[model samples]
Target: MNHALAQAVRLAPVVEKVHGAHHPELTRVRELTQALADTTDDARIDGYYAELRAVTDNYTVPEDACEGFTSHYRALQESEQFWQNR
Candidate 1:
């Protein structure tokens, strides 16, 4: 968990760069990432990650977004073992 966490963290630095309402969300991400890195409970980590991803990816898929979520979700699952296991 610790090994790959840094890369996952580096993906969302924009939230922290700006000081505004978004700060709280990034702060929570930091807190949750820490908890996730420290946690060993499968259910806890899985539940937290699932909730986090759902909230972070709140954008709706436009009809003409060029692709369906199934493909995206499949790719995500294939590359991320944690997601695949789910």
Candidate 2:
């Protein structure tokens, strides 16, 4: 995996804890990150990118969110940029 993806993976659990497992935002992030991490197929990768574009809108930090949550979103955004540039 690339560095941004790896960083997002490493930060995911902490973000989940901060945002709570049941949060919709966390669910999408976890699923997308895991899917990308687990797949090498081109079709699946294309699909993942489509979904990721939609999901990126949710990666913003809410006014009331914690520092860890903000960091998590930053990592995710970086990961998205990495993939988009590839």
Candidate 3:
């Protein structure tokens, strides 16, 4: 498992325990992210990133990471959008 993927795995339980896993989109995202964290290659991460991107198309994650993976990914998404649209 990749180090970043390990972080992603840690993030998932935090997500579930604190935020519940009722939303399908987030459920899919978390599952994929868990898989993402379990992977051990570039191609695998890339593939999972695509799956995650698809699941996240219109979704905005809750801002309750208190400085963790969710916050980081959310910030990364917003930064990319800013750059992409700038």
Q: Model 3, range 13-85, lDDT digits (tens) per residue?
A: 6665555545446566668766655565767756767666776663356544345536535643543344335
Clashes of 2: 0
What is the alpha-carbon lDDT for the whole of candidate 1?
Answer: 0.47
lDDT of 2 by residue, 1-86 (tens): 88877877877777767676445567677777788888988688678757866775646576766877777778777776777688
Report RMSD (Å) for each prediction in the order shown: 6.9, 2.2, 5.9
Candidate 3: give its CA RMSD in angstroms: 5.9
Q: Against the unseen true structure, what C-alpha lDDT does each candidate score?
A: 0.47, 0.73, 0.56
List clashing residue pairs in candidate 3.
5-37
Residue-pair clashes per candidate, as listed?
0, 0, 1
TM-score of each: 0.49, 0.75, 0.54
lDDT of 2 at 67: 78
For model 2, state the Cα shift of residue 74 in Å: 1.5
Clashing pairs in 2: none
